[model samples]
Target: MLDFTNASKLKKIEVNYQYDKFSWDHPGSSAQLIRDGKPKDAGMVEAPLNEIDQVIQNAFNQKVMPGAVVSVTRKGITVKEQAYGYAYRYLDDQFTEADQPILMKQDTIFDIASISKIFTTIAAMQLYEKGKFQLDDPVAKYIPEFAENGKENVTIRQLMTHTSGFEQGIELYKMRASREERLKAVLKHSLANPPGSKYTYSDLNMITLGVLVERMTGQRLDEYVKQYITDPLGMKDTMYNPDIYLQPRIAATEYQPWTGRGIVWGQVHDENAWALDGVAGHAGVFSTAHDLTILGQMFLNDGKYGKALILKPSTVKLMEQNMNQAFPGNDHGLGFDLNQGWYMDGLTDVNTIGHTGYTGTSLVISPKNKAIVILLTNRVHPTRNTESINQTRRLVARQAADAIPVAIPGNKNAWFAGYGDQKNAILQAKVNIQKPSVLSFLTWYRMEEGSDIGNVEISLDGTTWNELGFFTGASDQWQEQSYQIPEGTKFIRFRYTTDSTVNERGWYVLQPQIKTDQKNIAPEFTSTDWELRNR
Candidate 1:
């Protein structure tokens, strides 16, 4: 007696704060294990598991650095946590007792640099949630001094989204004689672009935000962050200034020529932030992999932890929304960078959010999938000539993405069949049906020039082919097209023909399937061979 009608639906559980609020210390339940029996094994990711080790090994092998730290989590489970290589490479070469190799640890503090902006943004958003300020409110409303230099109307949202039109950067470390002077310089600076007309990523925007937070809260940026965000969240290792006692454990950074700062170990690396005494909204925060993972997970949980609503869900959504639509691929969300495929390759979706640091650190959060990847590296140590770690970032994220299985509609894997080489003939595929049925085909294709044409065809026999439709394949973007099969056709085949000798990669086909049930008849194929020819 099979009781098919009484099958129960799965229950949803709330496990947002199963781990600690301030740190990733909670070894929460595994997201993969929980979903093992689901229709699509979404939990299974194909990351090399050992790829983190390979990245570390290659860094040292290439002499890019001596060590690095990596952490990844999905849904609430910490899938990978690793530290590789020596924390102090110069010590290994010296051979002295005090210069012995120091292995990197899970809690190793990294000068996260620009990745700090996310935290600063979170703090600002917290104030916004409290009604301390509205996003479109003029900056002069909070800091009257900022009204100087015809910049009175710049809104808080503009600063958060890098649409303030301020200059890209200022060498405050070189120009200002004092911290007050530096703050004054930022306030008085005028627009480089029209406000909100374009996205010009400016450290000045965040630096101005830091000043605004102070003016509104009557507190230093670090003090404000500690009281409201980190302290309540339990991120003890996160701060603008690392305790002197922890200096020995901090990873080293660039040895700057300015001011003869020998080796920037355990200190803020940004010159302007250093001039401000190691506290700025745009940079100068130090934290660990464990601490950052907690922050990332908080966002994954929709701005809550253990019954505490740190941010309204709507607010978090606003933070993740892409505001710079004018700039197609340059995705920017309020205070957070979004959809950056170069570093966020596998981790990016419409809701994927994260930021990168100039000093070689990145945090990617996928709220839709509940995944996070944290990579910390001292790529600029000893010198800044090391290779960019963007490829490694992409590989790690791609591995995580590959692990999540995609659910096909009919429990059948989709097929992509297409043809076209650079030179002569066209590339195509064919399908045949004996009676009326549903046919669906989708292809993401592009070509080199305007003459490039790739088309779809349905034929009855192997000899003669009839065109179902034709499309200009020269779209700059991957375009999708579909067609239906007519009744009483014995065979159907698809063909892709390119018009010119260009570097053509053809098209990517997805989920091509046919439904045969007559009662559930598929959509009609309005095109006959003659109609297609006439068109």
Candidate 2:
């Protein structure tokens, strides 16, 4: 009976992929799989990341580097395993002396830069499900020297959706050439536009798809991603360079005194994947926040794990859908980067996929909350010009998206729209309404569309306001709203206008009625940035 009603296997997994088209909706609710220490054997709920461990110990007490390692998982339980501050605190790049360092643990080790292009786009979709080619086949159909220059029409789905305008890497370590002449100058680099037209986040398109998966598997792209993706998912500490006895739980990154490679611990820190010898499919990998949460639980199990399937839950639901609809907010997916509320903050929806790593990492998976949220950091340990781990990657993805709980209807009270950043929230009421009134309730929202919203105003004079509707998309569930309160309306509200970006699971209101013409007003309300919780 474990079919779990597959809902026709999620409608054969992606027929024009529509998880409600995108205002966010996914896993909506269902997680159970944690064993022993039991998140009640998986009815899930443990996520107390003590404000994500005090925002990674206040960004390592404002030094911003010197260590971090976080892990989280929701549905399959292991809630949050943390560790912060110095995985090998300085002995060079002059973080001045104290080299007895080594504390951040729950399994240290992380370079994870460019999240190694989604493990080389999941080892080229496990070799496009072993049929080998045709993702619109074209990087000159398996590197015929990548069709020199005009890039012979770039494809493999526009290099897994960075939209292939290619121009983000090839600095092949200040070019003294040879790494096959900087990979043939990234196959004759030129087009920074016009190749699926826009979005250009390239590392020479995954170092030419890791030399077209080492020329379609003559081996070596780290031995075909450790023999078919991390030794069939066991991920023994994730790889791509680990010889020198894992160097005391490896962490440190950047201290490269002009490529004389001063202090980059345990190798691989993206000097164009350490000049290509470190296995580059765009940044040499090195993992461990629970070995990248077992590859984000094999992408929330769409690609199976335990009995190891590799890929194909309709190609892992086409790698989380949104293939750059003409680059709208760059929500890629194929190498996963969908719904990025700037580092998946408040866990931006569209089926939440993730990837971030230029030394200070990020992973976030949330496959509709079958969740995962990594966050590995060395922030650039000794030095890479710190400042900007994008606010601890949006505060550990808004504390694992405010520990996922917004849906308080029958379990009691509601009316909460409180997240932060350039905020403004409301909940006012003073209705005497001498004539027409209707206002029933039960609303929901998820802002950040053309810059946040959630309004439902009206006023007579408690400060002139007017629009009685507007809640920017992403209902993902609740809805039963109404409004029409004209005649003598004394005032009524529910505002919530933000813009300092990324907020979801924010707006909600519940069971409020109000058929007033005078008597049944049921007023008694007046709040700001809104809340009346019973969470």
Candidate 3:
């Protein structure tokens, strides 16, 4: 029921947001929740999900990351879970491989960098439900020092949505005199822009939120999270500053000589979080793919896992609602980033929510499909300088999305515009129409509006083409489109063009028929990047 089709323009271009389908309730099977099952048991296609292993292996083969662990679930069923490559590949900054490198396992823990914010946000929500503080209340009310330097008017909601106008970060590792002064340094930092005027993602916002939680609950952030969230959900492998005994199973992060921390392992990766003694709101939670999926399933279950109810169903709805309406494309909820096609990709929708970590970690949940994707990697291992894992995230997410079949009208085969970004692709067939005729076909698409677009065109001589109609956003359903073919038309084609950026669930066309005065003709297609697919 979340529709942005008529919402205001996104930056320079207009967007019409729509979903392929709609479902208010959890779209899951009637089986046990979060249990291991085959893809089809959850109404998912197995082949697409099977492709995930090769994708992760390719990342390892290319050395994009040292290791990775992935988990996928649909309709409350865990369909895929696997590990790849090495957890501790390098020994130093010179890319020295460890003599005894630890191979990754399904239980190998990872430094899930910024994902800690979601846990902090959930804890804060619990306190909010307990009437500890109102969201609109100024931070100055609870932490008096926050009122300094133009921050008195900043509300809790603004901080949660990253609109407090705080700078991204100040590098507390270099700025702080001691670990004791870190909080003081953060409290005294000045605003970069007037709050409520801009949406700048800043670690300061979540750090401050962590401090607020500690102040209200009279417990450390890690202690509070373990007691309230992790412990109750039975996420045994998730924690802050993982213990010494767990180091052998933990993945290594970047090697930092500047901070005198060589080959960061068995500890927090973020220098700022380390400055805070490996516990902060923004980072420092180490977890495995299996454990993270439990947390994800909790959200898909409306904040409940089994008998434990972590949040009210209404609260979860509020957490998914977009609060930064003034900033068009930067949609955000209480904690999670919303509708981010950059990483969410095919799973990106008005209701799809997710979060990403700096150390190559991501969690995406689609409420409509009742699906969850967890991709954890030690991409920063040996060094922070490496290839971006954004595409890998998108491809894996798209695989999970493709597994959920769209109901092909009449259950017939359809032409799929193969997924990619920054390309001009065509699916065309030479047609000899001596007289005027009507061409009709069915299409279903959800693309990046104003950027990736699909067009139906015809050419008199198969070279110069004229557009008949175009589509950019979601079609909502399989829509039948008809156009009049001219007498001299020689080529009928569907051309799809995309910008160099995020890709969505690509276009699908089915059952093309041309009706003349005599009879209906079925045309054969020669495509550049289209596939004949059965949805």
Candidate 4:
């Protein structure tokens, strides 16, 4: 029901904002810099309609579980929806794209494993937007039973951010006798670490939230989710429990060894949630790529889908704000994983939000970029022993990011400078200086293995170098160092050498400048500053 006209106007404005932020060099020209090959023009780089199809064909071609479905959207328009592989490989019935196989159709339902947390999170935020609850409100307020075992102080915000200090996981299916007992066990369990000390992604946080929603609304979590989110957003296929008629369209999950649940198909694969009747806040929602796209767009639209405000714009903003500041790389927002380099490849760092399901599903949304990448694969089928589909997820998301031509044509992908593996061989970058001029060079560096003996050197040429300084190498501590280049230097170079063996991942560079006179400003020095140095 959204007005595409208004959305289009808003998208144009947003694109301009991003273009400025990224300092994109051209309007509508973008390139994907292949390490060893010529940069490909993203606008013309054609592959399969769905980027995941390409990945599936490459990595998961031999796997079972029928097929895979992937979809990507930008500014409310779906750019791709592709299916590959089999919906039921062993079945004698030949499958085609038209058949809508259990795992292959555009609308085929998927047990989105932990992706259900996003729905629960949005539902909770909706209640908050309606003034039904406060983010800081203690869970004990709605579910008094949750206050037991020193958990009276656990706030809703903590649960959403996975900072409640609950244990990573609990096998409710094996430990508890019944659903009621499982619920009781969750409420009675104590914290593994002090609350809010650090992020330990836990299912208990959301399980408790599910209980809170049920207790407050006098409705099951699934019912509340349907009435508030799915129904209003017109996501007809998303639900915690599907009818028998829909089972044939659902993809298979795991072959559990302990729960006696053989080859879980058309049922929630999580053992703990399965014990709780497939309706927990952390997991157990079944949906399709199309249905999930609606939710993705809602977040991209800042919580308004059509006329209904499922969540306040402010609440959605808070969900995208990083809460794991103390823990640097483990970027997390309220109920959303963020700034994940491995999964959110090529997306804006601060503006993108996404989460991955254990069942090989991932959703990456970049509101600022008006982009969404959804890859749904049942890599857990036949077995859950596979290491991780992170590479595939990253590749697909990067492909989507690459597809969006940067407003500027020649801007290079952001640089990721890190220490090389060779302890004795120092990483170096050289900049050529043609004429005598006063130059300012800026360097950003951080040490992975904090060491007091780490030092940097600047060289006029490859033979002789001058020591910049020494600093204790500490993880995640980025220090900016600047210097002035002396006149008459033919070339300048930087070397990060360590007296003691230690690892580091940071950057060194020369800042760009605007020339006052109409003379050609020779390109600056430093490895990252050079256009085509090492390659």
TM-score of each: 0.73, 0.35, 0.93, 0.73
RMSD, every candidate, angstroms: 10.9, 20.0, 5.6, 11.4
Those runs of model 3 whose alpha carbons end farther than 4 Å from true positions after fitting are 1-32, 175-180
Model 4 lDDT-worst window of ten: 7-16
Error of 4 at 376 (Å): 1.0
* Count of clashes, each model: 13, 3, 0, 10
lDDT of candidate 3? 0.86
lDDT (C-alpha) at residue 19 in model 4: 27
Q: For residues 2-42, could you state the per-residue lDDT of candidate 3 as single tens digits?
A: 12233222121121222232123453322124789999888
* Top lDDT prediction, candidate number: 3
Instruction: List lDDT for all candidates, in order.
Output: 0.67, 0.75, 0.86, 0.65
- Highest-scoring model, TM-score: 3
Candidate 3: minimum summed lDDT over ten consecutive residues — where? 7-16
Ordered list by lDDT, greatest first: 3, 2, 1, 4
Looking at model 3, the pairs that clash are none
- Please say which candidate is ahead in TM-score: 3 or 4: 3
lDDT of 1 by residue, 240-300 (tens): 8788889768887776767468667778988999988899989989999878877887787
